[model samples]
Target chain A: MEDEPSSRPAGRPRDPGVAARVLTAVQDLLITNGYAGTTIAAVAQAAGTGKAAVYRRWSGKADLVVAAVLALNAPVSVPDTGSLRDDLVECAMHYARGDERATRVLASLLSEIGHDPQLFDAANRAIGRPPVAALVAVIEQWVRRGAISADVPTELIAGIIPTAAFGSVTLRQRTLDTQTISDLVDHVLLPALTGAHGSSTQLL
Target chain B: MEDEPSSRPAGRPRDPGVAARVLTAVQDLLITNGYAGTTIAAVAQAAGTGKAAVYRRWSGKADLVVAAVLALNAPVSVPDTGSLRDDLVECAMHYARGDERATRVLASLLSEIGHDPQLFDAANRAIGRPPVAALVAVIEQWVRRGAISADVPTELIAGIIPTAAFGSVTLRQRTLDTQTISDLVDHVLLPALTGAHGSSTQLL
Candidate 1:
């Protein structure tokens, strides 16, 4: 859903505040009405903006929804703890601390996202790629230091916590507590990365 | 969502075939209309039965939909391949071979299921728990044989493949290919379970 900037009539310089208001409206609609029920017209009405204004920013519902979700998520800061285990634990903690409203919005989008390629790509770009990138960078540093094997599938290793965190909220309706996050890092991720059982006693 | 057999008026013996038809209707409607759009009356109409007939069988839409999804999935046969890796591979293969329509139905239910505890538990019973039980059984056998450490989180180990499979389909919108499954088992599951890097070369 690419915006055709040229197709839009030369209008007043876009209102910066309008975009934020529209995104907030989108998130609200997503939580209350879900993907199928949230329409452009409804979002525009909720935002107190004209339908044309919404379309001017986003090509369609998928584009708008993806933008809303992206805005909702604050980027995870990449931690540079010297140890791979510590870096991963920090990342996992960041994921576990995500707010419930954002989780609900994501859960509400899951059904529709799976079916729509555009939405799926948009969601992946917003929610999936950044954390994986951060983890990859950390793992690469460890690999360079010979702390972990170069043969490890870096992307797969990176995906574990995010996948688990996503499953915990979206599938099981549970938040990841500190104990569970500690267990995951100590028991699962460390061992997978280092080819040695995690020093659970040492870490805990 | 539990069926109250006692609550049914002393009526004609239940038509075994009606249950099947109603479940089929639910699957069809779920694929076409999604969870929010699918209604009990519409399902009954689609099944060529009265609403009473549908409700007598299931308490409501959540109950009916869960049954429909359960019926759509054939139970995974737990493999006793003598190797935990082999057993996990077989299970992963079964998951990879799941038909597209069933995947679509599950995808459609995800949004509603996350919000409704009854639906969430019903879905966990139907879709989440059985394969996990099978994996736990296999892992436990390995633990007993001393092939893996007893300290491994058995349930978490059991959950890895299913979680990956779910993430592959629901989040990425891609089915797990044979190579990807082999990589996951060798590169991720094997290491996490045994504290040894997967023999990717040997396994492949």
Candidate 2:
């Protein structure tokens, strides 16, 4: 069992990329074996590291999974797609494009995290918070432009966008089609959010 | 091990309640322990049956869990709440209330199912198809009422609702709260299903 070889340069050829390599392996294991089946040994074998190397940084199997999944699914800075709706669509579509296996891995981890809320606390912090915050910034621009409601709480509601988008797979027993996702954004989300008040009366 | 006491009798002898009791217990285990942790032995223990009894009814653990979840979350049926929006909200809220452990169980089963989708084919058949099927029924009612578009393909969109509602909990690391649930029915879902034209624009 060796200590975690940090990313910094090493004098003795310490295989400095071990941590990242291990995390990637963990991601693969999570996709294949699932959260419960994945073990420290499996991660070690996949990463080409000893058990001690894994233990140096992670407390247990759950810790390893949290790190690995967050590495893969954690929201990055929101892309500046120029339009709020377009940017949100791209964000939703990022998870939408066929990657069923990764979606399942994320779904499984979510189940585990729900049961044991703390399992991914750090991972959630590292991964869950940032992109939603970025989304908040973008949507706030909408609020200011009066294209959308200033009354809308972006932080609270914006979080739902990605959750609804990437979550499309778990939501559908099969896979999500393109128009369903577009409807989710254009119709369901915007109307309820903006209260599209007069449209209903006009339709009548 | 004792056999699963058959279906509950009219007066309740002959151990007729065995199947019902066992299915219920297994479902409870699914929420608490998740799919991996919910073993046949554990289900037997919780149901107060012998391991042999469980095997007699189910080929394996997956069958047992699928039966349990399906029985618990059966189509309770939705009332025509006048408007499509109201019907959708009521359905969303009803979908939200249930085994607090459902989100975790869903994540667990969803992840593992990919490795062997056939194993869950029975589950998909017996337990999986009904509730969402019921929601599709609700959507159809709205379309007939002209509250929603007949062209909406309500069945397809209805299918994604349960998955999205439950997935919201897992992915967001939050509970399926009423407002969020309502908003989903409102903001993201209703417009797509309702044919609310000009929902995104009105120069407000």
Candidate 3:
């Protein structure tokens, strides 16, 4: 999953503060106008940047879409709450809330990307893996400290945690509230992480 | 989340068989072409029917897409292997092999549906809840059979299995091979399902 073949060139920053503003504009455009309606000129105007600046950074609509997704991909720093339960619960909330708008953009971007694997590489490099890697890093530390187990692959376990959150958003049309996320983390996610087996759970 | 406020349907079924054929064509096209490339004309061509026939069945392309997704959305048919290890491991392989093109299509479709609430009901009815509910049913049965704990919510436990498989496919570009799925089931997924706390798994 990790072997993406994109080398970052010395253009501007992949995402600068101005670029973030542009992506925020793109996100707003995405939510309001839908992907079909979003235009480079509209994004440039919204961000108060020049068209040249936008083009200088991203190659075309697909490239800009990926950049916007990357800007949208940034998850806030997860807190080390000393307990896995606390950390995950907090992470889920932060995850669910941070940029509902941005995440929505991903659905649109992925829609476009699925037909074209070339876009997948760009999306993976510019947008996809950073946040996932962050969570995996936390789980890796836990494994190192004997907090979690070495028997489990750090990447796989860490990967499942974020998957629940994104899948909730990806799978359904609901707003993906905090309580729903918390419920997932506390009951389903933790036990799965611990691998506790005895009896089946009651329906929720 | 449960209450979709504006879920009025356009029409009811006329010829379910024809609709089924159209939907099956849609699934094949989606598996083959993806959301962006799928068209009414193409679907009609593939199904050996006219475009009017498809329109009579669904409100639009999105509605048609919903049907295709639901075609593969059978509930969690977790195998009764008489052991959690065997059941979960088998479940992972099923996840890996069963209609992967549909799986990828859903990954993209899911995100797009988040942006369009009008299709929410159609998506849920056609594609969403059956599989998840099935997974929940199977997990609950397992728990009642003394295979898992009644303490966990079935919804939460249900979330984990797919969270691993879908998450793996969507986030990382890995082959969902049988052996890989087996490893995910036996080592990662099964362990997560059981509980990660114990030093070693004692249950079968």
Error (Å) of candidate 3 at residue B111 is 5.6
lDDT of 2 by residue, A1-204 (tens): 354445536656655688898988887777667666678988888888888888877898877777776666545556676655676555555445665555555655655665566655654665455656776766777777787776554665566555554555554434455565555556445554564422212110
Off by over 4 Å in 1: A1-14, A50-52, A70-74, A100-103, A201-204, B1-14, B69-74, B100-103, B201-204
User: What DockQ does each candidate score versus the true complex, computed on alpha carbons?
Assistant: 0.61, 0.32, 0.36
Error of 1 at A69 (Å): 3.7
**Candidate 2 interface RMSD value:** 5.0
Q: Give the least accurate 10-residue stretch of model 3 chain B, judged by summed lDDT.
A: B1-10
RMSD of 2: 6.5
lDDT tens readout by residue for model 3, A1-204? 111113546663444566677778887887667676799989888887767767766888777776676655554565687766666565556556645554556555544554567656666654456656766666666667676666665565555555665666566633466666666655545544555432223212
Go through the candidates in order and give each one's C-alpha lDDT.
Answer: 0.76, 0.62, 0.61
Off by over 4 Å in 2: A1-13, A59-62, A73-85, A98-104, A115-118, A126-135, A153-161, A165-179, A190-204, B1-14, B81-85, B98-105, B118-131, B153-161, B168-175, B186-204
Indicate the residue-level lDDT of A135 in model 3. 65
Q: What's the true lDDT of residue A148 in model 3?
A: 63
Provide the TM-score of chain A alone for each candidate, in the order shown.
0.83, 0.72, 0.69
Task: Output the worst ten-in-a-row residue range by lDDT, candidate 1 chain A.
Answer: A1-10
Shift in Å, residue B175, candidate 3? 6.7
Each candidate's fnat, listed in order, reads: 0.74, 0.38, 0.60
- The regions of model 3 sitting more than 4 angstroms off are A1-21, A31-36, A48-53, A72-78, A115-122, A125-127, A173-176, A188-204, B1-21, B31-39, B55-78, B115-119, B168-175, B187-204
Tell me the docking grade of candidate 2.
acceptable
